[model samples]
Each structure stands twice: as C-alpha cells, then as structure tokens.
Target: MDGVSPKFVLPETFDGVKMEITGQLGMIWELVKGPVIVPLLQLAVYICLLMSLMLLCERVYMGIVIVLVKLFWKKPEKRYKFEPIHDDEELGSSNFPVVLVQIPMFNEREVYKLSIGAASGLSWPSDRLVIQVLDDSTDPTVKQMVEMECQRWASKGINITYQIRENRVGYKAGALKEGLKRSYVKHCEYVVIFDADFQPEPDFLRRSIPFLVHNPNIALVQARWRFVNSDECLLTRMQEMSLDYHFTVEQEVGSSTHAFFGFNGTAGIWRIAAINEAGGWKDRTTVEDMDLAVRASLRGWKFLYLGDLQVKSELPSTFRAFRFQQHRWSCGPANLFRKMVMEIIRNKKVRFWKKVYVIYSFFFLGSGQGAKGNTKGLKKFPRIFKLPDRLNTLELGFAAFLFVCGCYDYAHGKNNYFIYLFLQTMSFFISGLGWIGTYVPS
Candidate 1:
C-alpha cells in the first residue's frame, strides 16, 4: 500500500492522454462542422432527396407504361415501309400536296452539307417540293459556302432558295418565321423542318406526311432522333441511351396515351394551317418549337410521334456544346412554362389529366435541366451551411438508404448509374440553386 501511494504517475499520464484524444476529436467535429445551419442544410438535403424520389417514381411509371403498351396494345396499321405508298399513277400525278422543306441554320458549317444534301434528296415531286435554306450564319465564309451549296443543289434540278436576313432578330426561330413570310411559301400545304445537323432518310416525308394528310386533325408529326455520333465517345453513348429512353419509352407512352409532349425543335413536319392557327412561331421564348407545339395542341390540334421514322442527327461533340444545349433546354421550358401555364389552366380544351401531366412534365423539365458543374447560383448554396454541423442520425440513415439504392441499381445493370450518381451528387448544388434563384431571387 505504501509503495502504490508512492507512484501514481501512470494514472496521471493516462488521464492526460485521454484529454488529448478528446480535444483532437472535438477538433475533428469542428472541421466537419463546416458553416452553420447544419439543420437547415440537412432539411435542404431531405427536400432534394424527396425530389429525387419523385423523379425516380415518374421514370418507373413511364417505363412500366411503355412496356405494357408494347406488350399488350394492338399494333395499329401504321406503316414503316420505305417503299412509297403512292403507286405509279399517284407518283406520276402532279396533284401531290405542295411541301416546303425548311432547313434552319446558324453557323452550322460542320453539318450543313449533310442536311442540305439530304433535304435535296427527299423523294417528292420536283416541282411540288421547295427547299428553303434559312441561313442566319454570321460567318461570311460559312454563308458563302451555304449559298454556293444551295446553288449547286438548284443546278441539280432541285427547287432550292438561299435566303438571308439583314439581322438575326430571333436567331433560328426568327429565320424560320421570316422564311414563312415569303410569297412562295403561301402556296405550300405543309412545312417540314430539320435542324442543320439532322439528316432524314429519303422516306422521311413519305412516312410522316401521310399522317398529316390522312388525319386533318394532326398538326405535327415528329420523328425520333438517332444519334450519328453515338459511337464517338462515352458522353455521346450516355446521351444516346438517355435519348433512347426518352424517345422509345417516354415519347411512346405519350403517343399511346395522347399526352401533351412538345416537338423536339427538329425532325418534324408541321401543317401550314396548323402553324398559322397556333399563332405561328413566336420568338418570345428560346424554345420556339415547344412553344409552338404546346400552343398548337392547346388549340385542339393533335401531335403524332413516329418512333419508327428515325432521324439521324449528330450529337454535340463537345462538353461545352452539350452544356450550353442543356442550359438552353432547361431555361426554355421553364420560361415557356412560366408564360403559358396559366393559359393551360384556364383553357377549356385541355383535359384534367392532361393538364396534370403537362404541369408535372414541365416543372421537372425545368428542374431537371440544371445539373452538375453548372456555376449558376453556386454562391447561394454554401450559405445554407452557415450553421454548426450537427449530424442527424435519421437523415444520415436516409442518405445511407439512397446510397444502397444506388448500389443496387448499379448491381442490376444500369451501367449509366455513374450518370445518375453524378447528377444526384450535384443536384443540390445545381438543381437547388436553380429553384432558389428562380423563385427566391436575390
């Protein structure tokens, strides 16, 4: 007992070591503490999670609906044969409807030749078909080349016109509207539009025009896009799969159910009357095509999506192009939704279910547009973390559940899981920032 009382240094050292460890752990917690508002940030995180869940549910529903349609629905009498339905007598007759093929271009030098060449090759009566090349190119070289190409096609016995404006007032949509103003177009019965990058098959008009001709109520017939550069890179491949899911599953379901889906800005044939009836093309919004489609649909016109009539187009080969495209997509829909939603609600023509779907579709359409690495509202997001970081066990568990779901999805062969993961991770940054920026303002 005397010896033990004489040496208690070990116990003191042990207590000192314990205090040091406690201090280090406190420092670690402080580091994770980050900015304050941990609770608010956690709430924001949960809200994001809820949005993600909604997104997932919508996708699942679309997939199921599309699959069921393909499996159980009767294959209608729709034809996909490349052989012209018109027999020899009808083919020879000059009574075919006047069709104007419009190629909207804006410095699209890379793919202009392919598109113009393809348009010239469209199998329609030589006199009845008018190829209008709307060249809004600012580049003198590109403009000259485009004009020369139009000349070359005209020399080949094709009725082609190269038109330019003093100024690109509305960019692409402006040029298209201006083309429609020409005296030549007034006689055209229908207008087939293709972006500069799209190359429709020779049967493009043959397959799509009949729908408009036979069904007077059909306003627009849109064809599915098949990416020409899908094999060029992993990004393109990812884009291809995503677009396929959209066209095959979502668009098909819309077609089967008569839902209100908009035109893809290209590869569509529009009735001249329908275009005029729907208030024509207005450049108030950047997504003039979708705006026109929605307006036309609201005016009791129907849209037909032909998944079989594939339009091969080049995907934007660079990330910068893809990003800008995405940004435009997100913003345009939001802008249109903002402008037209009240009209949609007040309109008597839209069915209740259709209205619901349209609202839901565009809300997410705008929301889903903002994603990873976009610097929009990048500053506002960090302020939510201004509170001390306090870990919420329940929320942490929910996050872990998401993690498991992602893992399960990857295991189940959605190799595009990487894309989903990247989007989800950046959703709070980009998506949340967008909503806050739009609604909350400065």
Candidate 2:
C-alpha cells in the first residue's frame, strides 16, 4: 500500500464498474430523450407549421387588400393638394423649387449613361434642377467612362456635377451622405435619388415633386420599378416577380393604409426638411434606405408610393449577383431591426398599430420576402416536389390579388382588420432562417 496502491482494482471489479456506469448513462439518455429531445422536436415542428400557416394567411389578407386597392384607389393628385408648377413671366423658371437629383454609382460601366441621361432629361426647369453624380467606382476606366458620361450630359445645358469621394466608407449610404454635404445641396428643397441602373421617366420630377411640395407631412415619394429585362433569364424573372409583389402589394398597402413604406433605394423623391429632421442618413446597416425610412417614420413623417409612376430599372441577372443582392436585402433589415427595435418601441410620436406595422409588417415581411425566394422548404421530400412551387405561386397570386385588395381596403375597409396580424411570430422566424441560409457560406 505504501508503494502506491498496489493495483487499484481487479479486472473483474473494473468490468463491474463499467457495466454499472453504462447502465446508468443509458437510463439518463432515455430519460433525457423522452422529456427533452422529443418535446424540442415537437416544438420545432409546431413552429414550422405555425409559420407556414401565418405566411399563408398573410398572403390571403394581402391579396384581398391589394385587389380592392386597384379597383378604387384614388390618384395622388386627388388625395393630396397638387398643382403644376409654372415659370414666372419675368423671372422665367426661377420661381420653381430648386430640385437636386442624386445618382450614386460604383464602377457602373454599363448603365452610367442611361441613368445620367434619364436624370438630365427630367422635365423640371433647367435653371432649378441640379444633378449630383456620386461616383464611387474603383476602376479607373469605369470612372473615366462615368465622368465622361456626366460631362456629355453637362455639355447639353444640364446642370450636372460629377462627385467622387476618397473612399467608400459606408458604401452607398456613405456616398449618399457625402453627396448631401455639398454646399449646393442646401439650396435644393427636394432631392431625387436614383441608382446607376434606374432610368426615370421624363416627367418623373413633375409627377413626384408635387406630392412633396403640396403636403408638408409627406417625407418621401417612392415610385414603382419597371424592369426592362425581366424576361432576360429565370433569375431575373424571379426577381421581377418578387419585386413586383413588393411594389404592388407591400409598398402600395403600406402607403394607402399607414402612410408608411420603406423608401426604396432608387426612383424616389425626398423632402430635404424631412431628411434633416430624421437625422439625415446613417451608414450603420447595408439597407441604408430602409434605415433612413424607419428613422423618418419614427419622427412622424409619411411616405407616398406612386404605383403608376414607374421607373425603368434592371435586376441582377446572374446568380452570384442575385445572391449578394438578396443577402443585403435580407440581412440589412434584420440587423436594423435588432439595432432599432427598442427605438421603435419607445417612440411616442407614432401610434401603437403603426409601430407594430413597422416592426412586424415592414421589417419582418419585407425581410422575409427576400429570403422566401431562396428557401428550399421541401427538399427532403421527393414525391411532393411541386408543393413548394405551388405554394410560391399561390403566394405570388395572393400578392397580386392583394395589390388589388389594398386598393379595395383603402377605399373600403371590409373587415380586413385581420390583415394587421398577418405578419407575426412566423414571419420573424422565416426571416431569421432565410437570413442564416442565404449568406452563411458553405
């Protein structure tokens, strides 16, 4: 015993101990599985089913609201005070509110001319309109091309300024923020923003500016996007479908009912006062447009969606580009939600329902829509391959129907209170799962 413990145990004793330990561990596992594992699995299943049901209900409710919206939604001119601006006889185009157009681009070799041309051609008084081309292109050749395009437009009697920053600090948001810091931007009462790919109509300004001018309460006038190459490929087609739903159903409904909707990054006009009051732009999240919109909404500002005022734009035709776009679209809002949920909850300026709509409907549903396309819901099943496809189609149809229904609901409520609850716990989970799946690299 003094030499070390002469052998601690006999082989037979060790074997007995091992057997007893194994039995105890097995019993513990069984108990754990029965009470803990099984219930967790069941809870997961229930959550999935509940989410499916909630999304389905949301689709239905949106369908009904949008349908009614299309049939009877009044034109903006009818709802808001609007009047065509005319030049003063002596001053001649000097009385029009100075408007600033911002085009933010980064190495956009292909669409630079188109966007610049479209903005230059806006039917505002030449003396009153100023266009800012925020070029963040890293490629020297592309930068040269974009700057040349701006010069070409400038030579045509258009008041255009080509702007470049030392670095892309905040990506698009940073460029936009810098663009506003220019001394000339202060003289402009209203600002219109277009991405490099957007080609607004000639009358885009005439159509959009009046809403901001006539209504002091309105912060933004967001226009619908029309993709010229929607039929280019399957990917673009899917994008078109989703974007159409976003513009038609989601944007329209939010504008009609709540006077709120996320400010799409492009093809929109903003009241400079509202932007200033909303603390300008913060580059905290990738979805800077949505971030600004939420901040503006919380400050008691309203947005107007112009469904008929369509602006031509292009969708990402490649899978790689689409994945990146979807990732930003999905993740930015979730991050923004996490960042601003408390700010939204504590704001005393907005009503209870509006806060819910922003948190539940705008943030959740908007983020969910981006992830919904890339989800593989029933990949585990081989027989019912068409189920997810059918559900997607049904959802799109519901969105289409709801675009029409939002028109109806706007004109007539018709027991559509349920629409308020369409997006709830289920949407939050879908958004989270979708965000995780799309961008988490393999």
Candidate 3:
C-alpha cells in the first residue's frame, strides 16, 4: 500500500509551457521585426550607400582637379632652384651631395643580386655614394648569398656595406631605421631606399638627386614604379593597371596640389635632415612608409613625385602573395588612420585644407583607387536600393565613361589592350572579395 501510494502522478504541463513560450517569442520577433530590425537594416544600407557616394564624388572631384592643374601647372624646375649637375670634371665629384642607398631585403633570394647590382651601378661618385644592404633574412642561406653579393660589389671598389641584425624587431622598418644609425650614414646628406625587387637605372641618382638637391624644402622624391613582370600573368597585368592609375593620377595630383603624397617605400630619396626631423621611421604600423610621410608632412616637410622617373619592380605572381600584399595595403592604412588622426588634427604646421586632404582624402579613403570601388561593390551593391535609383545610375555612368576613355587611350591598334581591359574588370570583382578575405582569420 505504501509503495503504490508513493508512485504519485507527474504533471504533463512541460510541453504546453514550452509551446506557450515559443509562441510569445515568435510574436515578439514579428512585432520588433518591422519597426526595430527592418529600420536598423535600412539605416545600415543608407549609411553604406552614402559612404559609397562620398567616395565616388571624391574620385570625380580629384579627376577634375587633376585635369585643371595639368592645364597650367608649373614644372618642378620652374618652381624650385633646379640646376643640372655638370660633368664630374667640371663641377668636381667632391661638390656632390653624399647619398646613402639602402636596399632592404627579407629572404629575397631571386632578386637580391639585381637590386644590389643596380644600386652599385648608379651614376654617382664612388666616394660620395654609400650603398647599404639591410638583409633581414631569417634564412641563413639567403643571408650568406646577399652578403656575398655585397662583398662582390665591394671588391669592385663600391662603397657598399652588408648589414645584419640580432633580430627582425621592427621588420622592414627596423632594418631601415638601423641602417640609418651607421656611422658612415651620418656623412650622407640624403638616403634612397630600394626594395629587393626594384631595379633602378644607372642614371636614377642623376635624375632624382637634382630635385632633392635643388629644393631644400622638399623632404622626399618619390619615383614611379614600372612592373617588369606585368605581362607574366593575368594577376600581374591587373596589378600593373591598378598601380599605373595610382602613380599616374593620384600621386601626380597629390604632388601638384598639396606638395605631398605617400612615400612609396622604395625608389625614393629622403633628405637626411628631413628624416631626423620627422623622428625617423616608427614600426607602430605595418605601413612605415606612409607613417613617416604623414609625420614628415606634419613637420612642414614637402614631397615630390616624379611620374616620368619610373623604377622597375616585380609584382606578386601568385594569388596567395597578392592577397597578403593587398591585406597590408588595405589594413595598414586603416590602422595608421586610427593611430594618427588625433596627431593630424592637432598639428599646426600644416594648413586646414592640408589636414582635411590627409584625413579625408588620403587616409580615410586609401592610397589605391580600386579599394573604394571594391568596398562599394562588397557592401553597397546588394542593398543599393536603399538609396535613390538615380544615385546608382550616376555611379554606373562614371564607371562606364572611364572604361570608354581607357579604351580610347590604349585600344587604338594593340589587341593586348583589350585583354588588359578584361583583366582589369576581372581584377575589380576579385579584389572586391579581398575586403572580406583580408579581415577574416586565416
């Protein structure tokens, strides 16, 4: 009797309670879905569309400004005190400014010799020119090879030094910084940087040095990059086109209007005084070049970009390498913006418009023109209807117009131009995905 009594009946109410809770939750979601969730999503879409329009407007505005400037812009020689250096026999080799050529390498086994040879072959006085090979290769074999190459150049009476460090503390930035600390470099009036892949002409020094030598106010002389392997693959060809646009339009505009542009990290010469005044290179971000340029500009230092004086360099051939390169190019600027926005705002040396240009036009947008387009395609293209149809049509029109202009410029008789145009279009779509690929964890 006690055992039977202990087996009390359990309430069958659990299923009913869960069903009631789920029904209430569903109702709540429906209630908030229209007013709260939908509006929030619509607001996000609107914001994205607005950003896209702003970027598009800036692109167009810059284009117009470039055209107007080219109409009557004074050449550097006209504005600055540019006197061509006479022959060594006439002017004397001792009168030339001492230059420190720094070639930074990191396991670049294939191109080290080319860069070293090109630099040593520069048409400058042997006594006045100092070539520094900053080899930060972790691979011992690569390090040995680079050192031997430097020694080989040294045997030819070239004043080239082979430099190594205990560790790659700041990566490329640290190596460059250390290279400047040498006792011999103190004698140098200017410093030129070359990446491992770059091969400058023998007269590179003869042409670029005059700008820095003549213009005391100019902090840096940035040269254009010409890709040696642009025809190697479709990826390389696309990169060539994108970079061509950057050097041709953006750099030219910056140099002409603001007297400023990002130091392209290599194939550029920096006055030693300007480098010290800007506090040298800091490794706070991956983009040491842009960081230095910003700091230097804030200190009232100006930069010059010579579009005609192009230095030959190799582009990344593989997708994996290209992805990493794009990640650095895209993310580093954002990171630099985050760090330097306040500094830029507080600087009194630069004018108000210069500050605006740096923050709004340079860092906020990006060095590459394609990033904004790519970003828009990724974020705003799907929900583009959040904005007016007219706005979308305007952007499409601009794109189509640019395409037509490019065809007119390059597609006269060359069939390769057609292939290049198609590759560029393909490049745009694929690079748009990089916005996602770059940030996502590998």
Candidate 1 regions exceeding 4 Å error are 1-43, 76-91, 369-442
Per-model tally of clashing residue pairs: 6, 20, 0
Model 1 Cα lDDT, one tens digit per residue, 1-442: 6566635888898999999999999988897777665777888989889888988888889888988988886543343222234736745746578899999888977889999999999988888899999999899999999999999999999999999999999888899999999998888999999999899898787777777777888888889999877877665776787788779887788877778887889998999999999898899997998899888888888887888889889876554455457667766777788899899899899788888888887556434744432433222233433333232222233345556666777778545674575445444333333221222113
lDDT of 2 by residue, 1-442 (tens): 5775546657768989999999999999998998999899899999888877878988898898888888887877888899877757898887689999999999898999999998998898888999999999999999998888888888889999999999899999899889899998888999899999999889888878878888999999999999998877665776787788888898888788764688888888999989899998899998999999999999999889989999999988654366557777777788899999999999999999888878877677767765664422222233423443213332333345445655666567776643642442233334323322223223
* Least accurate 10 contiguous residues by lDDT in model 1: 432-441
Quantify all predictions' global Cα lDDT against the true fold: 0.78, 0.80, 0.81
Native-referenced Cα lDDT, model 3: 0.81
* Cα RMSD for predicted model 1: 13.0
What's the TM-score of each model vs. the native? 0.75, 0.78, 0.79
* Model 2 lDDT, full chain set: 0.80
- Candidate RMSDs in Å, in order, are 13.0, 12.1, 11.7
The top-ranked prediction according to TM-score is 3
lDDT of 3 by residue, 292-399 (tens): 999999999988888879899999875546645776777678789999999999999999888988887667678444253333332323443455422333234434
TM-score of 3: 0.79
lDDT of model 2, residue 273 = 89
